[model samples]
Target chain A: DAGVTQSPTHLIKTRGQQVTLRCSPKSGHDTVSWYQQALGQGPQFIFQYYEEEERQRGNFPDRFSGHQFPNYSSELNVNALLLGDSALYLCASSLDRLAAYNEQFFGPGTRLTVL
Target chain B: AQSVTQLDSQVPVFEEAPVELRCNYSSSVSVYLFWYVQYPNQGLQLLLKYLSGSTLVESINGFEAEFNKSQTSFHLRKPSVHISDTAEYFCAVHETSGSRLTFGEGTQLTVNP
Candidate 1:
């Protein structure tokens, strides 16, 4: 079975520009979540999507948004990005809403570089 | 709000030696704890997790984490480290009521042969 997949592998954008990152959920999984990992830091939760709607969100601002398609794939869009937004954008998928026993499977993240 | 703290930023141990990486979390509600390992240039992979039943959880790779509720800590330990075990280890906590996870700054483990 395929694990989570994300693209493009890397990107470069200037401040105030927008970018969209994509993710394909793991086989048999329905929930998708996005995270941002800054250099030398752990991954921070961005938001989660289930059944084509956002189910939960972290402390990120409105500039960060996401969508879940019917097939459980997801897209994370960052608008008006700041230089600080340069980081590794990670995508994770789980069987369902992350219950007690469910573990998330992550993809090779898309590295975003903001100039 | 939930938060995690990993006491060590980097840890180096001789191969075959036992190792322990410290983690502590604070949450107002009951939470699920997890340990994830990320190899260089790779995605984070779940090593083990503590959900409800067992205070001690073991990963397939012989790593284990013991959850100490009284101390609000979940420290990952391995009886004998290998050079292949060198990677970044992250501690995360997800509240039972929510799906969002709060993570600690990772600990980079380097096993020297």
Candidate 2:
């Protein structure tokens, strides 16, 4: 089975610009979540998408938004990026969005560099 | 809200030596704990998880962790380490009523020969 896959393995964006990172969830998975891992830090949950709705969200600002397509793929968009926006963006897939017991599979992650 | 703290930012060990990485969490509700490993330039991978039934969980690579409910800790340990075992280790918690995982700052394990 194919694991979760993310596009634009790496991206470079300037301040005030917006960027979109894509993700295809693992095979047979239904839910997609986004996370941001800054240098020397662990990942922080951005938001989760289930049934094409934002099921749950972390303490991130409004500039960080995401969408889950009908096919279970996802896109994380960051608008008016700042230098601190530079980090590794990860996408994780699970069997169900609200199921606690379901394990999550992660993609290789897209490294975003805000210049 | 839930959060995790990995006590060690970096741990260096010789090959074949034992090592322990400490983790602590804070939550108002019962949580399912997890440890994820991330190699250089890679996404986090599940090491093992503790949901219920067993206070201790083991991975295929000789890594094990014991969940202490009273202490709110899930510390990862390995009896013997190898070079390939070097990676970034993250401790995370998922509240039973929540969908997102709250993660720690991560501990970098460097196993040297």
Candidate 3:
């Protein structure tokens, strides 16, 4: 089966501008979560979407938001981006949002560059 | 809250040599642990996980890790390494009551000939 997929392999945006990154979860998965991996750092959880609603969120600010469509696809939107926003955005899908035992499959990720 | 710490930022070793990457975590509640590997220009891939049961876990590859609850550590090791084994390794923790995963800064392993 195909694994999780993300769109726009790479993106470049200027400060104060907005950007949206898309993600299609792995087949047979429903929950989607977003993460940010800065240079030389591990990924930090952004938020998770389940049942078309945000189920859990990390310490990120309000400027970072996400949506989960009925088809289990997801979109991560970052508004008023700053230079520090440049990072690799990863999307992961799991069988259930609340099941701790369920493993999360990740996508190749979208590299965002804030210029 | 849960957090993970990968002790080594970079580890260099000769091919066929043994290697060890250290990881430690802190959590107030029961948590599941995981190790992920990322190659150049790639996303994170699950290496192995420690949900419960035996303290030692092995991956399809030669990699294996032992979970020490008292020490709150899960260190990854391989008896022999290859050039293709070079990659970035991350340690993560997921609290049983929470959905988010907290990851470490990552360890870059370079297996050279």
TM-scores of the candidates are 0.97, 0.98, 0.98
lDDT of each: 0.94, 0.94, 0.95
Best by DockQ: 2
Candidate 2 lDDT tens digits, B5-66: 89899999999999999999999999999999999999999999999997999999899999
Candidate 1, true inter-chain contacts retained = 0.76
Stretches of candidate 2 exceeding 4 Å from the true structure: none
Better of 1 and 3 by lDDT: 3
DockQ-wise, the better of 1 and 3 is 3
Task: Give model 2's TM-score versus the native structure.
Answer: 0.98
What RMSD value applies to candidate 3? Answer: 0.9
Give the least accurate 10-residue stretch of model 2 chain B, judged by summed lDDT: B94-103
Which ten residues in a row are the worst by lDDT in model 1 chain B? B94-103
Lowest lDDT block of 10, candidate 2 chain A: A96-105
List the candidates ranked by DockQ, beginning with the highest: 2, 3, 1
DockQ of every candidate: 0.76, 0.87, 0.87
Q: How accurate is candidate 1 locally (lDDT)?
A: 0.94
